[model samples]
Target: MGVSALAEGGSGTSYPSHREPDGSIGIKLLEASSNRKNDPRAYLYIVDHINPGTRVSRRFEIRNTSSSSQRIKLYPGAAEIRHNTFVPAADRHANELGSWISIDRPELIAPPNSRIQLNAKISIPKSASEGERYGAIWAEVASPSVKPGSAGNIQMINRVGIRVYLDIGPGGDPPSDFRIEQLTPGRTEVGMPVVKATVNNTGERALDLGGQMWLSDGPGGLNAGPFRAQVGTTLAPGYSAPVMVMLDDRLPDGPWQVKLMLESGRVHHTVTGTLTFPEKPATWGLPALLDSFPLWALVIVGSLAAVAVAFFLVLAVRRLRRRRRVAQ
Candidate 1:
């Protein structure tokens, strides 16, 4: 990005044109030579183009024809170039200045009668919303550093604005919308369980609901269903549909987890419920006989009776031994 003065053979020095960090042509500043009584003028060559969502590095060359070293300051601002009337699509007004899509450093220094080049690199954000963005890069020559009485007052303030047009395409698919709730068991004898799930349309667009569920041993457990629910052709905004899930009574007696899965095209979501069965007491054929024997108390009585029988046997054996001794 090199800009030339193209002076019309004037008496005083003229400033060079402004160029974007990229090689594109920008604004031009025309400064009258002190000896010549011509007024300074500014000109710009606006460049417009589309930038794909990618990192861009640009280099700009500024040439100084003055006798003293000059200081330049570059800044980023809204695009002021008039080459084309470009407005971002309505969905793209959220981008802020100096975001990932902004210029690197915006300042530079140039020596006398020589050219200075500056490089700028910008990275587009990955999370940036999908839409078109419009902006520009602005460069202005700050107060020039000069010696006393150097070619009249440095009267040239060069400004160049470059228009940036960017288009960010659509991102990955929207997130899945599914939730599980209201899980309960049917009856203790049957050991049946029922679960309810609500699937809602949380995305901006309509989604098709189709998938299955099954009981699993773990959170990632078994396929509960391949149960189909005709949630209708479309789920309007903020609308939800109810799905009832039932477990077979024949399912073994133990802790069980029910899983309900919902799928829309390639997207899949799952919800789970856990259930436990309580132990039941044994029963006899006769209702009265069931409580007739206090089993725990009877066990204690039997243990005491066995202890008494052993004690009596020991006493009888001792008496027999004494009688046998007396007879001897």
Candidate 2:
């Protein structure tokens, strides 16, 4: 979800990384499917749905940002969505989808500060199952210090990859959607404003949750943010997770109209509510009454109800006047 870089160590810990000027090898998607051209996720990873017996191809690029030549190994590895995370298998393991994927070049020597494009093809057998499969196309580089077959030495491997989400079926792609269950406003221990949205994946496919939140109608009519939801939270079907958006610390804490939009590919949902942060740190406050409804919709309904009430009152007055005249 965030910018991926070379992951070091097999220590069973997840480390965050980004490309730097000091030389790093990286991987990226080079092309997206024509059918999925409009979907942002398609451009980031190998996301698609195809029949069991068909094959699909995608292009990707690997770059050597160092000053010296590097030996890069290309391969497909096992991956799974466990506990709402895309976990890559350890040590070049293979899954169903990973076995099906073939890189045109398994290994290559990359010149310094050079780029190489390669094609990865996935050929599904006729017996493939009718569900989604997960894997990754990885580019790994080993540290030069670790000589080959150095049994007693520790070998550090740094690799980057693009995720794969491939669904096998006979018909069209499955529906992808989600729902926002609740919104809570809070402050961090240091008093930074934050909003936590509980989201549920209510569809047949997994969701990559990402979106922006806007705050308006605050104290003194002040407004804030189109703040982004921290990326990297993925939800499997029937799963629920919290998506959070942190705001500027300088923002005042009372009665803000919040609008949040979340999506996975083309499926999107918008939620509106009223929130206020609590006075204490690391505390949460509930949304105001009718906070789930948009303000504009509420105003329209209220206006219609007022007109109906006025018309009924006018009829009542006329009927009373007629009764008085008849009695006279």
Candidate 3:
């Protein structure tokens, strides 16, 4: 896991680009468990493991980035990992996890360019199931009332939130792990090269996937990127999904060495191989010659074989000299 500064309303940066023009609001996690201090996800979300019948509290901060004051509403909303995505339910739809959460300040008037801190308390029942749940702590702002019959007078609402991934169990926390199953090279409809790595969650907990890919040993020795893996892919326990990396469109197809690194929290995995993007635009290519065999592994095997052959040849020459000497 890596640590990053909490973004104002988005991922990684203090000021996000998608701020609403009228009045933008931001929310971020303010506290993380000491055990997970090094995990970046803990600073961006409410990620924790709690025992049954235990009570826990987490603090979060909200910001008003607009010139005028804004009224913000805070609550817990349902979320689920569907199709490898963390999907929050529509309009504050409630779930078991959301029901268990209680915010100390549900509504507040945030002064212009000011920040407010709030506390959320979660109480797990003794009979709670031994599994993980997903939800979000949301801060929302709605447009002020528009005059009747005004042009395009539709009121809009914008909300930003911190995700919550909570696991309820007894005793020790469940282990988190995953593996890269396969890699496929393809192109999007617009001819941009893409590599999709199939990943499987092979442990008892969910994973929020992130990583990077580097290309080398290309045609004419022309090396390419350390392109970033696309984010927002979450995998539930025992499920599989694709983590995609989109490469530069102008990159040439070649027998390029690919090094991919993927991680979630503290767990990390690296995979290396050779790949050539599909020549046909928008199509996925067949597996390359060394798709399954890594270049490093191949080099090591070849070096060992060469050493063995050289030793055998030396022995053969010595034996022939001994036979000739005996004949003489």
Tell me the tens digit of each residue's lDDT in model 3 across 1-328.
1111112222221212223334567876787877788776677678899999999999888888889999988888888788888877654565688779999999999999887889999999999988888888888778787898999788887777778889999887799998786788999998999999988998898888888888999999988877878887889999999989999998998878988888887788888888889888879986534345644467889999999999999999999999999999
Tens digit of per-residue lDDT, candidate 2, span 94-161: 56876899999999999999989999999999899898877788888886566668875666787788
Model 1 C-alpha lDDT per residue in residues 112-231, reported as the tens digit of each score: 666655554556665656543445455555454567787775554555443343345454323435333233333334344443455565654333354555665733443344344333
Query: How far is 167's C-alpha from truth in model 1 (Å)?
Result: 2.4
Candidate order by decreasing lDDT: 3, 2, 1
TM-score of each: 0.29, 0.81, 0.80
| Model 2: residue 112 alpha-carbon error in angstroms | 0.6
Model 3 misplaced regions, further than 4 Å: 1-23, 91-94, 146-153, 288-328
Where does candidate 2 stray beyond 4 Å? 1-22, 91-94, 145-152, 288-328
Model 3: per-residue Cα lDDT at residue 229: 82
TM-score-sorted candidate list, best first:
2, 3, 1
Candidate 2 CA-lDDT value: 0.80
